[model samples]
Each structure stands twice: as structure tokens, then as C-alpha cells.
Target: MKWSEISIHTTNEAIEPISNILHEAGASGVVIEDPFELSKERVDRFGEIYQLNPDDYPDEGVIIKAYIPINSFLGETVEEIKDAINNLILFNIDIGKNSVTISEVNEEEWATAWKKYYNPVKISERFTIVPTWEDYTPVSSDELIIELDPGMAFGTGTHPTTVMCVQALERTVKKGDECIDVGTGTGVLSIAAAMLGSSKVTALDLDEVAVHSAILNIKLNKVNDVVSVAQNNLLDGISEQVDIVVANILAEVILRFTDDVAKVVKPGGYFIASGIIGQKKQQVKEAIEQVDFTIQETLVMEDWVAFIARKN
Candidate 1:
């Protein structure tokens, strides 16, 4: 099928609202290209970032792209999306240039375009996330390779939040430890836990798609024997006391369930909370503290934050 590609040249501040508008208008797989990302220095505790080409980014502002299936109402849908973005100004948002353009492309191209940007990435001292289609050889005997399709429902597990969570798990999980991964997404952390020598790992996600993807990736990594995948809400009705509970979800969501996490984590067990943007760092920290968790370490990467808190 052919798809219409819509590109918006907008401000960094406008990306979220504009992306929402596009998604509501039936867009799929929104991509953001900000020149700032080209120059942005990542906190490389996990891995080194190769320099991105500046030619791919606009000089003055960010560009947002999304694909919408070509249809009779394509014009109207695009117009509605533009109007919604322009409406953001009423809410005091700077829409920036707000220029929108459309081009047609094949479904195959749309599906494969983003895959080029994803390859084998060693995100931590022990963990390297590799796309299933790529050929990667480990640099050391102890290097742990995790394979996943970039098309996985939640993410490829190479995001900074997941990277930090895996790194934290490496630090906290001990031989024969029992671990729970709340909001497991593609089951990366649970797989990491199992590979890191956890005796048992429970991977949970509320999204059915995520559960299936995690199950697939878990088995692909050959850790299915040690890890179990389940469709579950954030630690709801969980009773098992485990040595570690790792959650790489939003700070807001983490704050909502820190108590539930606290309940299931054994005394002196660790909770790895990540997927927090810098703005919500303090609130998440305080929430963890309120749950009787003593913060042992706070890992920051770019605008994201993760905490390794031990249950008291």
C-alpha cells in the first residue's frame, strides 16, 4: 500500500502536541528530527553515540514526520491536523515555523526506512542490544547479546531508560535472585535479569501486544526457561517477594505504583525505576523515598533519569 508522508518543520516545544495531532489524524510511526539531537551529548555511561549527519536535520528548527495511509479523505485529515497544531498557540505553545509538506511512498520503504538507524548497540558494560537482522559478534566472553526486532511493539530496548534499567539490574541482581520487571515492554530488562544470573524473572506488561513481543524476544534470547511473561497491570495483585523489581516506565507511572513495587520487593531488595524525564525527577525521587526506599544511585542520561532504590 502507498502512504502519504507528512513532514512538519516546527519547534522542539511543538513536537509533542503536533505529534499528537498527527496520531489522532490516523498517522503511524511519527519521527522527530531535531538538529539539537545531532549535537546533543549523551551521558555515555552505557555506550558511545556515533555522530549523526547534520545534513539530515534542519538548520533552525526540528522536523516531525509521520505516515498516513493514502485515502480519499487524506487532504481533510491533513488539514485537521494542521489546524489542531495551530490551535496549540491558543494554549501559549510556540508552533515555530509550522510548515507542513506531504509526499507519497511505498509501504516497504516506510517500514524499512527506520531500520537503518537501528543496529547492534552495546548499551552497557555487559549488555548489547542487537537487531535480529544484524550480524554481531561479542567482544568479550562475558558480553551479553540481546536480540530483538526493531518492529517490536514498545521499543527496541536500546532507549536510555531501558539501558539504565538493565545496567541497574546488572548491579543489583545476584546469582539465583528472583526478579520482577514491571512494564516489561519488550522484556529487555527481564531478559537481562535472567542472563545476569537471576534464578527466576517475571516480565509483566499491561499491553497484550507488549506481552507477546516480550515473550517472543525473551525466547529469542534463549532466556525463556528463566523468565516468564505475563499481561499484568503495574504490580497489581502481585504478592511474590523478589530480590529486584525493575520498571522502565514513565516517572508519573512509576510514582503511581512505587508503593505496589515496595510491597513486592523483599526487604533490602532493589527497585530500578527509570523512563523518567528530567522535569519529573524530584517527584519520582520523593515518591520512592515516601515508599521507604532508600535511594542508592540516580542515573541520568540526556533528559532521562533512573534510580536504583533499595527497599527498607
Candidate 2:
């Protein structure tokens, strides 16, 4: 239940890669907290919100957190955890002039502290994702409801990139179309596709954690029969050509697998590509075009771009 908090200040650009490295190290998870998440108290007042837009939020910094189990620190006296934290700090300083702050959390309260941050998030017009602990009753017109408790996986549809993908899904997926959600983080899009009447769905991700999370979410929405979950990459090791291919991943990876994405979709199939910054959209578009696909539409959210293309 005990946790250690280590905050690292780095560029929003560098946080993900560094956080991935930290995850590979020993950190269970790293929350790339926007400084806006930080709150300050006002004199003689209830909590007054600070209007800190992520755009205005300093792009040159990030807060990296790693939790250490209290039992391990107390009973076994694990110096390795401390060493790993120090190593992360050293690594960041060597790579860049970033700073880190480290602290410990009370064991008993650490487990539930994150709950305060994970609340009900309404994703789209027809769908709303609520945490398991939060009470929510969908209106009569609510077409779909996905419940989650983000257990050891990502994708609550809050991240800008993920939200863009979901929006793209809303636009492209139609009744009875087959959908393949590549990098199916937390199964949000796949379930959305199913609820949107994707006749058949296949969800794939290289991460086993994502695959497991996808399966659980798909079942939670009772869409297991419509959506099949698998662990794969860019349609590899799969033979079906879907009507829609949704891959929300880094631009580098998407361009690398552009041909594969095109091949995995049938002629006239929809290809929804997301997770690319505005500057990288041209490269992705060229890659898609090189593979005989044409961009039908583009959606921009913040600095990120999502392309809905068609294999012609």
C-alpha cells in the first residue's frame, strides 16, 4: 500500500520515451502529469480551479512518479528500489538538464489515492466511460457505456491522442463493418466500434497488458461476441482483412507499417490513423499514399492529427 513518488521535470516530448524506459526499469507506472494537475489552496475559499490549459502549461517539463511498496521497504529493506530511483534521476540528468523530486507515500492510503484522480469521463456523444466505483446512470438516449477502473493499463479515453482516435472511430465505423483496432489500448475503441455496430471486431496490441485489458473491457461492455482480442502487431500473424483498420500509435511506427496497414484492409476499407503530431502528418500521409491509400479526412486535436484514409 505504501508508495514512493518521484517527480521528474522534462519536456512533454521526452516524457513518454523516458517514462517507457522507466517502466522497463522497475516502475509499475509513470503518470505524465501536466503541471495543471497541481492545485493550490485559496484563502478562506472552497477549492477554486486554476484555468491552466495544457497548451499554456509548460511544455518543457513533466512529473514522473514511481511507487515503491511499503512492505518491501520495511520488511525486506530493498535498497534496489532506492537505487533504481536514483538511477532514473542520474539517467535524466545525463540525457538532459532535468530535475527530479522523490518522496514516499503511506502504505495504507497509497492504494486508494489514485482513485481521486480517476473519475467518470464522458468520451463521446453516444458513449460515456465511467469508473467502476463511480455511480452513473446513462440517459435513455445513451447508446453505449464503458466502465473501467484502469487497472495496470492505459486508455481511459482522456489522453488527447486517444480521444482523437475515439472521435475518428465515431466518424468512420458504420453498421456491420468489420473493425481491427491495432494497439488496442484498454479496448476503448474496439468496444466503441462494436457498440457502433461493427459486425465483427478484432483487437490487437503488442502489450500483453493491453490485450488483457482489452478482453476485460470488451466483456465488460458485453461485446466479446462481436470483438475478438489478440496480441499482435500491425496485423501480423492474422489473416483477416477488416473493413476498418484503426491504429493509434506513434507516427514512426505507423509509417513503418503503412504497407502492412494497407494490406490488412480490403479495398475501399477505412483506415483511421492517429497519435501523430501535426508536424508528422505529412510523413504519415505520404506513407499511406505510397501504399495506395488516399486520405479522406483529417481531424486535429491540439497539436495531434488523426487521418481517416481509404484504401482504394
Candidate 3:
């Protein structure tokens, strides 16, 4: 079988939404080749460092590659994807170079290509996201390990947005606190909340695929007992008040749901909003603040921003 690799040269801020676009286009696997990875600092706690080729990465910006079976619908799918990415400008998202290229590879190469793109990544002080197939040993007594499969198409939960969210969780989630994880993707945040000693976590996603992937990942990390997975649009119809509300979704989506989040988060609780580009950071902050959330902290990684807001 042959697979067409769709590669896009985009900005760091566009990685999450663009990866999502490729996944929705029926891409079997997605690989991110960011030059930043070559020079990013690591703790080296586990002696973990991947041997990467310089030629594989873009000189600037990021190259997002996804594999799709070479089917009759390939052309239409690519067009739809291109349209979807271009539409990102409507939300003030910078699509960067926006140049896309395609190439063909056999099935054997597809499997090997995407595998090396994932590894055990320690995202925060307490949380380390490890691929299910990777062998890793904890470097600290209090370390939390999250196992994820990128083939699930929700991501490995190692992106800057996710990393900032988990780090915000580390500072915000109190032991035995009730929490809600909006747009729960691979359920990584929900799992992290559960492991952080949250008594109960309600994981919600509008996409059925996300709900399914989150369920499998929650169970894989053995957090199904404390985390309840559900397919719901944002926090609609969810009346449970919790100590924290964490969402790693597009900034536009976050702006749309600030009122809903404000209503569901108990007074003085925390709301962690991520997957925002630098361009929309202030706008999102203002939207949430209008709903009674006071910005507590602003976290910026590369060009992505995550906000930690406390309900007044």
C-alpha cells in the first residue's frame, strides 16, 4: 500500500489546529518536524536524546507531516485540508509559510517515519508524557507518567499548549478537588488531574473520535476510576461545579465558552485555557475576564500562550 505524506510548513502556534485538520482529513499518522526540537533543552534525567537529521527539519517554522492512504479521494481530501487551514486566518491564527508539499512512501516506511517522532517527554514538574511503546523509567519519586499512542490521532500530549496546561494543573489542582477537562483530546489533562489527586474528573469532548481516544487513554493510564469520559459540546448541560476547569482548545473556542466556564467554575476556582496563539492572547484574556475571571498567570511557550485565570 502507498501513503501520501502531506507536509505543511507552518508556525509553532498553528501546530495543534493544523494537526487536527490533517487528522480530520483521514490521515493515518502525523509527524511534526520542528527545528526547535533540535536545540530545545532537556533535563537528561533519563539519558533520553533522539538522533535527528538536520535535513529533516525546516530552517524556520515547522513542518507538519501526515500520512493518508493514496485513495481515489486523495485530491479532494487535500483540497479540503488546504481550505480548512486557510480558514484559520478567520480566527487570527498565523498560518506561517502555509506552503504544503506532498510525496509518496510505502507502508513499511510510513510506520518507521512517524515512530521516531515520538518519545518520552517530561512536560512539567510532575507530569511526563511517554509513548505507550517507549521504555522509560521515572527519574523522580513523585513523577507522574502518562502513556499515550499518537496513532490515536489526538496527539502525544507533549505540545507546548499541553505542556503549559499540565504545568498549570500542577500549580492549580488541589488534592481531592473535583475538576472538568474540556476538549479532553487524549484525556491527558484528565488523567493528569486524576493523578494529581483530584477526587473526580469529568472529561468532555464534542468530537466522538476525541471521546473514544480519551476513553482508551484514560483507561490505559488506569485513571478510568476517577475520570468519567463524555461526549458533550464544551460544558453545555454540565452543571457540576468544580475547583478547576482546564481547556486546551483553539482560542476562538475558548472565547466562545468563557461564560459557560465561568458559570461552572466555583468562585475562586481556576480556569486553565490553552492552545492560543500569541496574536489572540489578550483577546481571550479579556473575554474570560469579562465573565468574572481574573487573569492569574500568563504562560508563553514559543508562540503559544496558556492562561491561568481565577474566578472572582
- Scored by lDDT, the top model is 3
Cα displacement (angstroms), candidate 2, residue 256, comes to 1.7
lDDT ranking from best candidate downward: 3, 1, 2
Error of 1 at 246 (Å): 0.8
- Ten residues in sequence with the least summed lDDT for candidate 1: 41-50
Cα deviation of 89 in candidate 2 (Å)? 15
Candidate 1 residue pairs in backbone clash: none
lDDT of 1 at 146: 92
Candidate 1 all-Cα RMSD: 3.1
After superposition, candidate 3 runs with Cα above 4 Å error: 4-51, 55-104, 107-112
1 or 2: which has the higher TM-score? 1
- What digit string (tens of lDDT, one per residue) describes model 3 on residues 185-299? 8899999999999999999998888899888888899989999999999999988799999999999999898989988999999999999999998899899999998999999
Q: Taking the tens digit of each residue's C-alpha lDDT, what string does model 1 give over 1-312?
A: 999999999998998888888888887568899898877766556455656878899998899999999999998998898889889999999988989999999989987888878878888898888889899889899899999873547888777788888889888989999999998888888888999899999999999889988888988999999999989898998998999999898887988898798889999999899999999999999999999999999998778999999988
Measured against the true structure, the TM-scores of the candidates, in listed sequence, are 0.86, 0.73, 0.75
Which residue pairs show backbone clashes in model 2? 1-107, 2-107, 10-62
Better of 2 and 3 by TM-score: 3
